[model samples]
Target: MVNRFKDPSAHLEIADLFAEHDRSSLPIELGVSRRTLFRYRDLYVHLIETDEELMPNLNAARQDPHFQKINERLGHLLDRYDSKWTEMEDSRAEAFYDWVPEHRR
Candidate 1:
């Protein structure tokens, strides 16, 4: 899936809002419950932290039976929320750019 938003920053905002789960006082209504969001978030964190190779090669991982379930779940959520995993990844890179020293950026 591809992010259709015109503004580049919208990617990060969408990712943040979609991943917010139950943390926000002002909640956004989405297709999935907060519990589902939290569960998927935890899974995403664990997957990225533990699988270094997978992060750089999600397309390949998506084809493997071991990772197919995650890919399907992510695709389902992305479809429901109108997002792409690549957009979430782009948001991570954007955040990293902000985290580094000003000179580095």
Candidate 2:
């Protein structure tokens, strides 16, 4: 069983697993007990990567009044840096011109 809309070859990992199980388990195909298919779900990656910085970024976005005030101050500081960017841009004019054209797109 595959979804009508999705390409099986494009989803090679999932398609291969289903095909392996179907060949071994389908009553009409193999006439035997079917093994359950599973995804290689490494759920620990996000849990493992959580750190001191993640909490601060999330806390800022959560927008509690105190955090929101800090977020506003950070935004103001960023705007100040942006305002002073012309001098920095002049210092790195060639690199900045080349880099920013790609980024702005």
Local distance difference test, per candidate?
0.35, 0.31
On the 0 to 100 scale, the lDDT of residue 49 in model 2 is 24
- Model 1 scores worst on lDDT over the 10 consecutive residues at 42-51
TM-score of each: 0.28, 0.21
Candidate 2: stretches off by over 4 Å: 1-61, 79-105
Clash count, candidate 1: 0
Worst 10 residues of 2 by lDDT: 42-51
For residue 3, model 1's alpha carbon misses the true position, in angstroms, by 10
Across 45-105, the per-residue lDDT of candidate 2 in tens digits comes to: 1111222333344434344444444434433322221234432122221223324467777
Error of 1 at 47 (Å): 8.4
lDDT of candidate 2 at residue 11, scale 0 to 100: 36
Residue pairs clashing, model 2: none
